[model samples]
Target chain A: MKIALLASTTLDMLPSLADALARAHGLSLEWYVASFGQYEREVLDPASGARQFAPDVVLLSIDADTAARDAKSFRALASQALVSFPTATIFVHNLVLTAPDVLSLLEWNEPESNARMVAQLNLELSGVALGSDRLRVLDLDRVVRSLGIQAVCSPRFSYLGKIPFNKLGLQAIAGQLVTAINAYRGARRKVLVLDLDGTLWGGVLGEDGIEGLRLSNDGEGKAFYDFQQLLLKLWRSGILLTICSKNDEWLGLEAIRTLRFMVLHDEHFAAHRINWEPKATNIAELAEELQLGLDSFVFLDDSAEERALVRAALPEVLTPDLPKDPSEYPTFLMGLNCFETLKLSTEDRGRGALYVQERRRRYEAMGAVSLEEHLESLQTRVRIRAAHPSEFGRVAQLTQRTNQFNTTGIRRTVDELRSLADVDGWQVLVCEASDRFGDYGLVGSALVAQSADGPIVEGFLLSCRVLGRGVEEAFVAATESLVHPGRGVLLRFVSTNRNAVALKKLVELGFVLDEKTGLFGRVAPMELPKWIELETVSL
Target chain B: MPHDNIFPRIQACIVDSLKIEPGRVTQETRQEDLEEWDSIGHLTIVLSVEAEFDASFQMEDIPGMTSVAILTQHVEASGSV
Candidate 1:
């Protein structure tokens, strides 16, 4: 990735950022220095012959003190950058406000005062970027605060008595910048492995029982419930949910099934190995069951021992320390940034149900169940809707969050999805699933383009809930029926990390695998299976 | 206290500037530290502090005055905190 740095003043912290960026696998940096005074003419002018090369990422730096005055200028610069390079990711650095002159004006003698100011600036700057989808605001303040804490606590840095965070904080800030860049580039964790006992609920379910659990309608219990709701929301937003608990499996299942006020039911968890086993072993099993790379999992547990066990056993899995207090759970969870989704889709909201359904299939398979019997029992209804203005938001979200089941795993923003909808040759369709249990919401989406050979499936994805229900077959049938009449429509299923389940559907639909690309393609007339019912809505 | 009436004025400053309920802006309330105390809201707090106290703060002071206690102390020391 080619990054261009745009600072209102000379970036005194560029070397640190450059060093960190060099350590990153595929990152190159280029600097563009323009003062706040010359921002209007110099920064806005695209063909001014100043920026000779186009950059993939643009970093805009603003001073906290002057951010108010420079906010409009920065917005304009961002707008210009978007027009110049639509694909480039723009990051706005929270302003750094510190200096002896300014400190004297505030009339405080605290040595860490400057550091506090920088944190405040970054927080404020993040607010500015919240309105624009084209720009992502980096929380430079949090980065600095963590570094300050590290500097104070670390034995190596203890001798540097009261090191002002502003002077040497860039090193840590640069590391965070690289991480954020990588996250934006789609290099992030796929699964969030949660601990059951104190992490998910207030206490162990085995001990607390159904009504005894600390989950309620108000106060601290409410906070835990709210946190569970947030996790459920994240699960729908495409982060695979798994549980690693040291508990009686029967009691855990009973609590999940019987607890009335439980925000996260049994359906919320995709994979779990609830036993009195070491958390590391359970976590490894969960990863294997979900078929996700161990490195793409983030383990969250309130217990220090459990976290340490997972961290020691699987160093690749990110295990962030859970906050001591329950009140800090929201902030601590939000700070993970592991499952930072750039887009939300209709398919995402029903993803939890999909995973639960997939888990049920696995359970049935253990009983030596026939695939046909399971399909027949599903009573699955696949609703195909055209890309309308009302459904645009969810469609775009699905395009962003559908990674494993995604044909190309390419993410698209709302604006890009809108552009695709407007394009003449493209057809975007969203598939919603409803079964015996409940409505699974929008579970699948497909994007196809008119090609000379036939209508080609550009993008195809199904919510993991509707995975084993032969919904993918219905999706292909729906596409073939919509695009071509009385003719065979060619469909392509590209393999991805989480999409191996999808390959089964291609085989079921008579798609032959290509020897060279390993991608399955079929030029046969798509047949809507009798088990799957399709309802088409005009938008 | 020399600035007994200042607390209510500060509260009013926050209520009017931050566009929050007047009841929410007590002397104990922090500026951007509140859940709704976001970027534009933070700027409003800065402007409100400047207007209520009839004092101008350097760009550096904005970051330090996040909490209610800190802002009160700063205002008291400067004859406007």
Candidate 2:
């Protein structure tokens, strides 16, 4: 990844610091820091070093005074950068109010003052980010406030090298920019493993016995409640939450179930290993069960010993050090960028509920006498519909997140999904599943592009959550009937590190496989199992 | 020269920032002598020296502040650093 920094101030130390920061976070970014105060010229001119650099990410950084003087210029600069490097992700800085001008307190109170102007600039910049996905405001104002205004800015430094910010402050800005770039590049953690006692709530479940737990609406317990609310927000945004606690399962369940003030319930958790086992083992087991990598798991625990043990054993798993004080937990968790994501989709918002539904089905399946009775009892209904404009985001998410049952292993972006939907003779369908338990949102998608021979399945994938219930076969059957009618639909599967289930599903779906080409085709009417009760819907 | 307290620190800062040999950075060594001391590297050198000496460099002084001797003199003249 190449990163170009175009700033008004002489941030000489930023590039190396940004590279180091990016490298620390497992990103290899080549940095190009333009000369001081070259942002306007570089962005406006096509031959500037920024344009020549052809970076994957461009950081447009300027001080508050410069931005306030010309807010429209900043916006124009961002637009020009986008025009120059169309594919590049531009991160423009939102200016922070530092030293006061001659007006001082009067200016602070005045709406038309420099301070207000900067605030308006930031507000408009935020609107830009909201409107366009390619552009983002780095929120350097927040970064400066975090580092403290008096500490980050120095009059001597500002006059001396045209360097407006403190050394560490520049480093912090670069680090944050690197993080934003990485997030834009689609590097994100998928799962968060939380410890119950001391981490989620303020007491041990066994000793507290659900009643004695310190979870409350106010006081020290409020911190734990606040943290749970934050975790719930993250979970709702598609971050899978699992528990790895060293406590009795029944007691943990009791605490989760009985606590009135608890923000997270048992249903909120995707999986749990609430037993007296090493948390490392439990985390590994959870990772396996969820079919996610250890690198994608962030284990948050209040216990230093537990954090250290997981950090030592599974070094890939992120174990953020818990703050010494419980009150700081919410703020601490909020600051961790491990769970940052570029976009949120319908699949993401409904992820936790879908997992909960899966867990319920699993529990029911465990109790049933046989597999047939368990699946039959599920009363699963898969609704296949044409990909709507509202569904493109979830369709893209399914392509990115679903690995096990993803045919062709092709990850499509939201734009790609939208364009594919519009292509001539192409059909993109989203599979929505609901049963006696719950609605599994948009669980799968199939992308088929028409060719001379027939309609070729460019990509097809079903969420592993709905795998065993014959959703994949039903989807294939529906696709064949919709696309080819009487002729065979050409199915293609590309084997990936985690897509064996896709290949297996293709085989089971009656697609004759060519081992050499990894292509599957069915010339005959799709013969799906009678058990798969699928209903087709309109666009 | 040995008595001047800032010379060794300046030399160290130069060597560290430019990734050049310690001996390569002497009183006679210009910014052009080191391959890494391009325009971008010059800014890095000035900032690094400023950070090392706890002194700030004026924009007017930046062009002449390229060499080690000039940098050392600038820092020493600032006095407080």
Best by lDDT: 2
- Error of model 2, residue A286, in angstroms: 2.5
Q: Write model 2 residue lDDT over B24-79, tens digit each, in one string.
A: 98877788788888765676677667777677667677777878778877887877
Best-performing candidate as measured by DockQ: 2
Tens-digit lDDT track for model 2 on A1-539?
78787888887677766777787878787878787667788887888887888887888887787877777777677667777877577788888888777778788787678877877778888887787776777778888898898767766567756677766677778778877866765677889999888988887788767877888888878888888888889999989999989998888888788888988887789999999989999999998887777888999898999999999999989999999888898788768876666667677888888887777777778899988777787887888878877677677777777778887777766656655667555688878888888888888888888777778898988877787777777888787777776676888778898888778767766678777756788655666556667888744
**Highest-scoring model, TM-score:** 2
The residue-level lDDT of candidate 1 at A288 comes to 68
Where is model 1 chain A poorest over a 10-residue stretch in terms of lDDT? Answer: A154-163
TM-score of each: 0.63, 0.85
Clashing pairs in 2: A160-B57
Task: After superposing candidate 2 on the true structure, give the runs of residues whose Cα lies further than 4 Å from its correct spot.
Answer: A2-6, A10-13, A30-56, A75-88, A154-157, A208-212, A389-391, A408-412, A415-428, A449-455, A512-518, A535-539, B1-28, B35-40, B50-64, B69-81
